[model samples]
Target chain A: MNIKEISEDRLVIFKDKNTLTIKEHEKLISLMQQIEESMMPILNVNVSYNAVTVQWDIFKMDVNDVKENIQTLIKNLDHIKIETLEKKIVEIPVCYDSEFGIDQDKFDMPIEELIELHTKNEYRVYMLGFLPGFMYLGGLDKRLYKERLDTPRKKIDKGSVGIAGGQTGVYPQNAPGGWNIIGRTPIEMVKEGIPIVRPGNYVKFNSITIDEYRRLNNDKNN
Target chain B: MIRIIKPGMYSSIQDLGRTGVEKFGQSESGAMNFRAMMLSNKMLDNPLSNPVIEMTIVGPEFEVLKDITIAVFGTEKIRLNGSIVSTASFIELKEGDHVKVGRLLDTRGYIAVDGRMNSNHILGSQSVHSQLLDIHPLRKGDVIKIDGANEASLEKKIMSKYPTVKTYKGKPVIRVMIGEDAERVKNLDSFFKESYTIQSDSNRMAIKLSGTKIEADEYDIVSDVTRLGLIQVTKDGNPMVLMNDRQTTGGYLRLGTVAKVDLPILADARLESLVYFEEISIEDARALYNEEMERIQGTYYLP
Candidate 1:
C-alpha cells in the first residue's frame, strides 16, 4: 500500500491491485481507523473500495510536513497493531407484502420465498455513501441479484429497502435512486439528522407484517 | 427579522457546510460561490462561516421587519425602496424598508446580515442539503430571525478594500491541477485545449461540461472519495466538475481538479457560457491559493 498526493491538501492511500476484494476492503478500513487515531491534524479520513483518502487543513500546517508524517504511517503499517473494531449487527424490520413490494415481480421466485432468501444472510456494510445513511451492503444471495433500473426513479421513498446488482440496503431519506425496491422498513435509518448505521457495521433484515410495520412506525413518530 | 415577499427561483440559507461527516454519506452543501459568501460576511463584520442566504439566477424580494445591516455580493442590481444602491458598501435597512434583488449578472448571489441568523444546526452546519427531505428551500412569507445590533454603524469603512464585485463574462479560463488519474485519459492535452460549454442542468452538486470527447481506458473506477473541484470525465467522455454538494464518493475517472482560487469563477459561470481549462502544477496551485488568502486577510477590515 502507498499514498499519492492527489492535491496540495489531499492524498489517497491505495493498493496497486486493480480489483478490490473483501480482504482488501477490510485492510483499507483498518488503515483508515489507524490514521484517525494518530493525532495528526487531519481534517478527514475516508475509505471507499480500495482507497483511503486523507485531507488536512492547508491553512493550519504545511502540506509537505503532513505528507511526510502520512508516509511514515504507511511505511510502518505492517508493524503497527491494527485495532480490532467491535462487530455490531443492526437488525432492521421490513414488510415484504405486495403493497410495499413495488418491484417484487423482478424476482422469479414466490414473494414469501424471496423474503426468506433475502433475510437469510447477514450483509456486510462496505461503505456509506451516494446518499445520506445509504449503506452499501455486500453479500446478497445470488438469487436476488438484479440490475439497476434503466431509468432511475425520480424519488424513492424513505425507508424503502432496495436491491440492485447483488446488493441490498435501505434509503435513509427521500431522494432520487435507481435500485429496485423489495420491501419498506418502518424504522428510520437516519435519526436527529444523523445516520443510525456506520461503515464497518453489519446489517441483517427481519421480515415483518404490514400491520406490524405501521404499528412500529406510529410508535416511532409518537 | 426579514420576511420573504417573493422567493425568486431558489433561495436557501447556507454556511461553510458540514465537515468530517462525508464518511457517513453526507455531502457538503455550502454556498456555491464561497468567495462571494465570505466577502458578504466580511463586509458586515460577521464570521466568514456565518450563514448567508444564497440566491440563484433570479434573486428574492423581501421586507425588513427590523433595522439591520446587510451586504449583498455577486449582484449589483440591488434596490432599496425603489432606489438603486451601490453594492460596494453595506446597506442599512430600517423597519418596513423594501429591498429587491433583480436578475443576477452571475448564476449565484449571496446576502449576509450583520448578526447571526437563527437556524437549526444539523451535522455541524446550517447548509441546506439539496437531496434531504427535511431541509427546505426558502418560501414566500417565511420570516427569518436574526440577532441584530438594531442599528447600522454610520462610521463603517468603505468595502472598496474588498475584492471588486465580479460579473462573469466571456470565455473565462479556469485553472486546474493534474488529477491522480490523469494517466487514465489517453489524450490529456485535448482536455486543456478544448472549450467546454456549461450545461443548463448544472448545479451545486456538479458542473457538466460538454466539449471535445476525451477518451479514457475505463469509464468507472472502484468508487472513491471526491473533492469539491475534482473533474470527472463520464462514460460519454464529457467532463463534470464536482461542486460543494457532490456525492462523497463516485465511480468516474477523474481528469483534474479546478484550482481553489479559480473555483469562484466556475461557481458564477452562467449556463451555455464557454470556458477553458489551463493546467498548472500542484505547487503552483498552492502558491496561487496562498497569495489570494494573504491579500484578502491583510486588507480585511472589521468595524
Candidate 2:
C-alpha cells in the first residue's frame, strides 16, 4: 500500500502482501502527473502499473533536478487517500469443447473439471500483451499452471482461451501461440481503439453448453 | 503512382508508429528503421509523419505507372530505370521507369512517395503490425496511391548532410544503460563487456543473441512493461534485444537497453553479425539520444 522510489525517476508500488486497488492505481497516476507538471522544465515523468507504461517527454532537463522536485511532490500527496470501488464482474460465456480448444489434448484435466476450476474464482487483468486484446489474467488456480508448448502453433484461432505458467487469457486474434488451450470465449476482447477489458478489471468465465454456445455464436453472426 | 511488378521478400506501408494503444496489447507498430523513413520523408518535403513504403531485404521491383517523385533511404544498392540511385536521395520517376532494391544493404529500406499513402489509418497509424494484425505484406500488383501531387513539384534539392550509419563489425559493440533489473543480473559488468552474435531467429519482437550467459538473482521477477532496445538476458545465457513489436511486459531479467539512437542500426543488422555491449550512464544515454534527435532535425552541426 506504499509507493517506493526505486530510483530518482522510477517508482514502484510495494505489493509484497497488499495488492493495489484500482483507486490507488489512479491516484498514483494523478500524483505522478502533478509531480511531472510541477517539475515542468526540470524532468519528464514515466509511469507504469501492472505492466502498462506512460512516458512524458521533458525536453532536455537534468535528471537530478526532476528527481528532487518529484520527492517534494510525493511529500504533498500524504493527505490524498484513494479508495477502491466495488469490482465489476464480467461473465464471459465460454465453450469448453475440444474443437474450439485447439490444444485441449495437451491438458490431462477433464473438460468438466477444468470448467469448474476456471470459473471458481474471479481473475484480475494484470496487463495486456503478446497480441491485440489479449488479456494476461492472474489468479488462476495454482493446480492449472502449465508450461507452454515446446513448439508454438502457427495460428491459434481468435476467441481461443489458453493458459501458460500461472496465467490465462483469451486470444483476441489468430496468431502464433504456445499456451495450452482449454476453451474458447465468444466475446471479442478488442476492436479498433477500444479494449474489452482494461488492466485492473475483474473477469470470470461462465461455462456454456455446446448448444448454448452455438446459439450465442449464431446470435453474434446475425 | 507505382506498380509492383515483382514484390520481393516483403514490403509494407509504414509511418512513425501507433502509440497510446499498447495498453490494449497493440504493439507500437512502425518502420523498423525510423531514421531512414524520416530521411526519405524529409527529402520529399513531405510531413515527417507521413506514411512510406517499408521494403525488407531483397526488396521489390516496381514499375512507375505514372510520373512521380520518390526518395529512397536505408539500404545500400538501389537502382531506378536500371541506373543506380544513391541511398537517401530523391529522384524523379517517369512513366515506365523501374525501381529495384537489391538485397538490403543493411536489412530494411524506406521509399517515401511525395504524399500520404492511400490506405486506412487504423488506430491513428499507417504502419502495419503484420504479426499482430491480419494485414498482409505488400505484394505484386498492389497499386499504391499517393496524395498531394503538387507537393512533388515543390520538393527541395536533396539535403547534402546524412547520418553515418554504423554497422556491427566483428563483435558489434552496442551501448546500453542498466535496466530496472540490473541488480538481478550476475556479473553485470562482465555481461556488458562480453561479445555476442545476432541469432538468425531474431525479428521485430525480439533479437536473440548468442553470447556469455548472465544469470538472475534468486528473486523471481514477474512479466512487466518493457521497451524496444531492452537487452533481456534469459536463464539460458542468451541475450535478447526487445524491439518495436515486443510484448508490452516480460519476466526475464534485463541487463540494460541499447541507446535508442542505435536501435535502427540494430534493426537492420544481418543475422550472425557479432555484437558487443558497452554500459553507459543514463545521462550519457540521454545526451546521445538528444544528439541523434538534433541530427535528425538537421540542427546538429558536425565540427
Q: Tell me how each candidate scores on DockQ against the true complex.
A: 0.68, 0.39
Top DockQ model: 1
On residues B170-203, what C-alpha lDDT tens digit does candidate 2 reach at each position? Answer: 5456777777778876677777667777888887
Candidate 2 lDDT over A1-222, as tens digits, reads 344433222334333443456555555555645754663452223334431133434344455555565556556666655445467676788998877876666667776777888889899765666666667676899878889999899988888888988888888878788889888877777765567776667899988878888888787768
TM-score of each: 0.92, 0.85
Identify the runs in model 1 with alpha carbons over 4 angstroms from their true place: A20-24, A75-77, B148-170, B300-303
For candidate 2, please provide the TM-score of chain A on its own: 0.74
- Name every residue pair that clashes in candidate 1: none
Interface CA root-mean-square deviation for model 1: 1.6
lDDT of 1 by residue, A149-219 (tens): 99999999889999988778898878788999999999988776667886677899999998999999999
